[model samples]
Target: MKKAYKKVDFPTEKIRKFLEPGPIVLVSSRWEGKENIMTMGWHTVLEFSPSLVGCMITAENHSFDMIEKSGECVINIPTVDLIDEIIGIGNSSGADTDKFNKFGLTAEKASIIKAPLIKECFANYECKLVDKQLLSKYNFFIFEVVKAHVATSSKYPKTVHYLGEGIFMVSGRHIAFPEKFKPENL
Candidate 1:
């Protein structure tokens, strides 16, 4: 049975707080000899076949220009254990701070991209900028995941999700219903 709920008028601007509570990732990028890390939650998986991912990085971010010019970046998934580092990285500036050194995060060389992967993260997706059509208008970037690295020890890692303001929610228990889906869909 479904539970009853109260519907209240919500702020239009804060609607994302309820709709887009996806996993927060640390995007690492490099240009020339400089490397930086930025915390991002405004991202989504657009396709499976070619593994396409789209994200929004405001032009004001320090890593924005670096990624735009480098045409590559590594999206690292940090677990709930690294919540402090994640929040700190998001609040700090890469232009003035050496995020890797400041946050005490390890930067491992990526397989196909110059951007280093965050060693502490559970998974890392090395991506190449494939489309820029919506970039100028929305600060959105379309990337193709060229390579992926994941930890095998744990099948599921607890990740954090932003809920606007200073609050965050950590991923909870897992639920599976693969049996109910079609074989091909699995």
Candidate 2:
């Protein structure tokens, strides 16, 4: 059964929620011995084979300078279990707080980048900036994954997604189907 509903114009300023289920990412960057981590939700996968990623790191973020200068960062995927820590990290700035110590997060060095990876995360991707064309104009940076790591125990980790207004949606149970839809190289 279907029911008719009234439609109205939406506000452009509050349209972030319209793009629901945007994955929340913890970006870790280091420059000149100063390491910082920032919570990011404005990122997306641009390519598959080379694992290209695009992220918007505004000038207001402290890690923005570290990432821009070092050209490297680790995209850490945290699970729903760390929701409180996630919120804490996002709300607090790394400029004045030692987020790693304050949040009790362990850091492990990456294979290809100088930035440390958050050991508590389920997955970590060491990335290097490959494009800078949109940096000045859109505060955007394109990166290529150089190395990747996933926790064996948390293979089926439940990730978190931002829904705006300080709310989040946790990833649900896995759904699998016949293999015909999947590509051979995937």
The best candidate by lDDT is 1
Model 1 error, position 115 (Å): 0.6
Give Cα-based local distance difference scores for all models: 0.81, 0.77
Error of 1 at 181 (Å): 0.9
What tens-digit string does per-residue lDDT give for candidate 1 at 72-186?
A: 9998878888888999999999889999998888888888889998888877778899999999999999998887776654656677888899888888877889899999766
Backbone clashes under 3 angstroms, per model: 0, 0
Residue 101, candidate 1: C-alpha displacement in angstroms: 0.4
Q: List, residue by residue over 67-174, the lDDT tens digit for candidate 2.
A: 999999998878777888889999999899888888888777788789998888776778899999999999999998777776556335577898889989887876
Number of clashing residue pairs, candidate 2? 0
Q: In model 2, which runs have C-alpha deviations exceeding 4 angstroms?
A: 1-22, 179-186
- TM-score of each prediction: 0.87, 0.84
Q: After superposition, how far is residue 50 of candidate 1 from its true place, in Å?
A: 0.8
